[model samples]
Target: MTGVSLGFIPEPLLVALDHILPSRRLPSTVFDSRKFRQIKASIEEIGLIEPLSVTAMDQATGNYVLLDGHVRLLVMQNLGLVDAVCLVATDDESYTYNNRLNRLSTIQEHIMICRAVDRGISPERLAKALAIDITSILKKLSLLKGICTEAAELLGDRQFSSDLSRVLRKMKPTRQVECVELMVAANNVTVAYAEALLVATPVARLVEGKKPARLAGISPEQMARMESEMGNLQAQYRLVEQTYGQDVLNLVLAKGYLAKLLENESVTRHLQQHYPDLLTEFGVVVETVSLDRRHFAETT
Candidate 1:
């Protein structure tokens, strides 16, 4: 940071805080009332030790730009204080002030770091100041790198990066977005389950006989577990197949994922590819997208 010696002239008047602060200095869809309430109460009781920073707009406008401490200034203004001390800080200096140390990130925190860079802060500089590994920072940025605006809209604090990464990792951008729509339409977003559905749905449609898989109303975790258990069964069967051949294992351990899969033609190939050794230890999941579509088609 550059050492600065700048003088402050304190002159403040009541102005709409919203007008004074331009667009958000950060990417925030949610303004936490609980945190703000606590902060407001604390400032009202103890008084503001750190002064707010502001800049003059112009000679005629009688407006000032708040560079930092918007929350504290708003609290004071709401309390009917006519004027409070404000320091003059350049917008450049304003970005670096009072940011806390980073711990493991919540989704929002990671988003903000990218937003900061998108606003023209250098990634190297921003990463250093944020005290995060640059590689991880870049990896998270890659999550939305080529995601269509349509698909990216489906992403948010909880699963934005993760979900986008999952789909984009496997398919073309157009297909990635299509997958994202299904994910949101189902009100769910996670990598494995989304991928499973993406692969499962179309195949189920194309298969000639029997109905498609039932994909909806199932959480990613459940699908993952089902796959895991099915994997164990496959391993057992494979051992049996090796010792006694397919005829014996098919007799005892056969009526699980494979039976269910064989019952449907469309997603059978997908199950074979993504989950080899269906009942072995590789795990397999019944293709749900196909099943649900079939159920709907039949009911109709």
Candidate 2:
């Protein structure tokens, strides 16, 4: 199929609020949601950074259909706004904007906050605009102060907690990168994981050359064992990272082949008659992308 162009002339226009009809219904509890409150606060503070997307209803009707920004429009209506700056879409399709939405990652959010501060936005004002505390704004401003470049890049698009950055700052750059790689491989960036990584870090890899404090009920020997195992895990994680893309491609091809093989009438009958157990396992794999039951199926 050929690609079709979308959007109206690629320019923003000032539209009367009455002309735009919202296509989606806002939940009654939306005003109580933290996200909605933030949207309202941000609009009140900065006056709508992202314009609503709309498409002209008719050539002579002087009306438009709201394609995106349902929440923004609701907030504006509550605020008694008479007009809005909107992007007039050429096509009426709103799926791309509504369903394929991408929120800013932790690092991207940090960068944006830094940019805004550099442009003379005060921490207090920014905090109010985001409906967050002033301390949170300060924490975000200093989020990447001690993170290694490689690890920062690895986590740039991940929605990890900012507190993890604080935990990472205690490790040496090399160990930080290793822990980050392990986290990425496991697809977990929780503070608990970061704390575990910190605990397993060798004293030499610590920024101040001091060992992590031992947890209650855990002896030094156990910590030593954990550090050793963590080192081995890092080695294995690096090996997997080296061929991750190729491994995924192979897995996909194998699954597709297996699915096709199981689709054949003869093979299905043979399996059902002579290898019912194996057939059940194969059916599960064909239906799901999980690697959970086989040797590759274990959780991190």
Candidate 3:
């Protein structure tokens, strides 16, 4: 097999701030944003951790087009920095570097924090660098303490509140996995949803067989009803999940057939004259670009 091509050069180059040109303009309000503040604070506390991604130098001007790290560039400029390390990309296109980025998930963040602490980085120093409280840093360091391997793996690529792990920790490993799967399937992995799942969990499924605390304004009867409803929902979700692939295949086949059928002049004319609504509906199905849930809902 052929080797994969590298987008940027392996070694970073020291480029002057004046030699790097931003690809886009930043709004004035960006300076006051929380993200910008955090990035600035991080840079101030520990210096720039990530190098600026730039295109190959233009020999005419002896400058590089800044592909990524515009905010960092602005921060360094505000701090009166003259030079920065830059990664020189092979191509000038910034789409892949800018738009097609994978953000760190909550679990991934936790793992990195743990690794950093293990590598002798103090929680206080990390909190300062991240512009967060030391307590928050400690909380992130212990994010996966009671979470099961399976549940943690399920949430590896997902971004959710660190507090969600607190709710999962109350349940047994099997129940944690089940609840995580349910939350993932429903695409609602918030702390609130996790708490609801905790409430619906059977006492036996909880750690130490303890009952889930009653939520305020909800009586035992209402809680029981919620549990029953949650069970039914999970059952239905599993049933749908099992058949989702086959359903998609059938829809694709049907869409292709309808598209071909609508292509014939005689058939299109007959449908227009006798069954205009059906023809319109068929046209919608044929025109759908993807088999995603949103598209399916819109078509239906």
Candidate 4:
């Protein structure tokens, strides 16, 4: 016999909000947040972009248990909405649906806005639908204007601030790509990090020939030194990136082996008596999983 295939039914039905009950209660404080207000406005303007997820409470009764979209349901209830369209799941496993979803990234959001604008949806309507100011919508629309396509694509799925895009636009295409790569590799796409990268940028690689007055803290000589150091650091980082995965794997294996050896009292006692420092270092390495923090062994 083959295993049963189970998933949410593709067909959604309009279920009365009263009949579908929430599985968990939201904190009272959530209702007063700016996020809740935006959600309420978005629901009012767009009439629920994403439908709720629910499962039948009983096989015979039509009443359903709300699986996900708790905030959206609350918004609907606040607006005196009677019913909502919901995807019905065959089984009641709501945890996967709630936790395993990906929210839109900043670049992905920018692309969505651009596509909507191209599709003839005015920025005013978009602002109303998203419950944000028109100025915010315009910023999202202009997100990738001066950014190179390569860098834009690299950060497409990352949740970075829009201000980073502005900083990257000031650099030449090659420099822009390098900066994006560094940001992605480090998993830090903050405005401050982007500004640091821009500061280290050589004047020749800048979009404008002259240096900016905003970077007053760094003199021309200091900027030149930063550029040299950044180049060397990037080279070193690239070399580390090449072996980082395998290095981590090897470290994990070594830590596991050491942990097992230390589990034996005789082995641990022998190491403690003959090589106390070495045993302490091994213990520190076994405690931490990150190779980047291996300095914990040396510091101790």
TM-scores for all candidates: the values are 0.30, 0.85, 0.86, 0.84
- Give one digit per residue, the lDDT tens place, for model 2 in 22-103: 8777789998999889999998987988888887666788788888898899999999999999887776675536543467
- Estimate, for each residue in 64-89, the C-alpha lDDT of model 1 and write its tens digit: 67666766665666677766666654
Please tell me which predicted candidate would have the highest lDDT against the true structure.
3
Model 3 residue 124 CA deviation in Å = 0.8
Best by TM-score: 3
In terms of lDDT, model 1 sits at 0.54
Q: Could you report the Cα RMSD, in angstroms, for every candidate shown?
A: 22.6, 4.1, 3.6, 4.8
TM-score of 1: 0.30
Q: Give one digit per residue, the lDDT tens place, for model 4 in 233-288.
A: 88998899899889988998998899899899999999999999999998898877
Ranking of models by TM-score: 3, 2, 4, 1
Clashes counted in candidate 2 amount to 4
Q: In model 2, which regions exceed 4 Å deviation?
A: 1-9, 25-36, 94-96, 212-217, 288-300
Clash number for candidate 1: 21
TM-score winner, 1 or 3? 3
Task: After the best TM-score superposition of candidate 3, give how far the Cα of residue 182 lies from its true spot, in angstroms.
Answer: 1.7
Instruction: Give the lDDT of residue 72 in candidate 3.
Output: 93
Tens-digit lDDT track of model 3 for 168-278:
999999889989999988789999999889888777788868664455567779778888897898889889989989988998898889988988999999999999999
